[model samples]
Target: MRRKSVVDTLREIRLLSELDDGEIAVVEKNCRWKTYGASEQIIDQHSDSNDIFFVVSGRVRVVNYSLLGREITFDDLEPGGHFGELAAIDGLPRSASVMALEEARIASLPSDQFQRMILSHPKIALKLMKHLAYLVRTSTLRIMDLSTLGANNRVHADLLSLARKVTKDDMTAVIQPIPVHSDVASRVSTTRETVARVMSDLARKGIVERQKDALVVKDLERLEDMVEDVRGE
Candidate 1:
């Protein structure tokens, strides 16, 4: 694609939408595009590469390995999502690995360029700070969940988080492209068998139903209640 098309694509990204046309043009001229196949590692944990990556197509996962070699998934990101900003901003090694969950296209900006953009653009800097604060808040919550919540509650919380509200009149929601049991287990720091059992119990309780492509949440309020009950315990 031409440079202008690339600029337009970048403009669509929420983080970059605030940039003026001249700034966007500069980014378009400086950024490099790269593609990775499914299961390919885009960035390794503790690596020193300080380039920020923006997902332009497909999906990627942020993962980290425990000392015992267990893999934990932090998040799944899709188009318009970006990662590696933390390292790029802080000048630290990557805290986790990033892998392409499917064939993916990414736009890469060198650390120097990213820093320059943030320094020159007050809105961009503000957005970056907000994004980092969000990451910190999310990490704190995850730590709390891991330390205090039971396995079942963790699974419930994970499912509820993955669900998106589907209707205005009712509490119906859906997790389209519902993740596999093993992936959910990884996220919740549990085994697949436990996740499967908890999911089965939820189904039996009529809280959620499994469909071919998604897990339909019958009552989002009930799911929220479940999490609150666990918190109260």
Candidate 2:
């Protein structure tokens, strides 16, 4: 595979989308790029490195371990997504550890450069604020689900959220690279066994089917209704 040039990789980053070619050239000069193998640690939770990172290719998961060493996943970021800005903004340690879910290419801008960019670029600043707002909102929802919903319903919400991200049609959706039950369990704070059972039940009900490389949601409406019924929506 051809290694992407600095400009090419910068072009793939959503956070830098608003930059003009000249602006990107400036950024290109200031940023550092690296690639990691699958499962490689990109950033350690509570570490002091404050460079903001952007995904140029592949995927990464933001996560933290509980006191008992149980992993709690915060989110996954694919190509075009960015992370680590919170640390840059607040001048604090990383809030979560980040690991590459697959072999991934990433770009990093030093905290000082990132802060300067935000101060100089109003659009970038606005985008950052909006993205942070979204993070807070989703975190609130997750907290609510954990506090009020049962394990099964939390699983439902997790699947529903995933399904919405890659909906195929009005009646169907396909989650490519079918989710790992253990990962779902971690995300929803349920046991792996519970996630397996819930998924098996979903399969038996014909609401979801496992394909060669994906999980197909056969009855998207029905699944939505199931989630809504519990949420009283």
> Each model's TM-score, in the order given?
0.90, 0.93
Clashing pairs in 1: none
Among the numbered candidates, top TM-score falls to 2
- Give the C-alpha lDDT of model 2: 0.90
Which 10 successive residues of model 2 have the least lDDT summed? 1-10
For model 1 the local lDDT of residue 78 reads 78
Question: How many residue-pair clashes does candidate 1 contain?
Answer: 0
Candidate 2 residue lDDT tens string, 5-85: 333458767877899989988887888889899999999996889999998888999999999998889999989999999
**At residue 6, what lDDT does model 1 achieve?**
40
Instruction: Report the number of clashing residue pairs per model.
Output: 0, 0
Task: Say which candidate scores most in lDDT.
Answer: 2
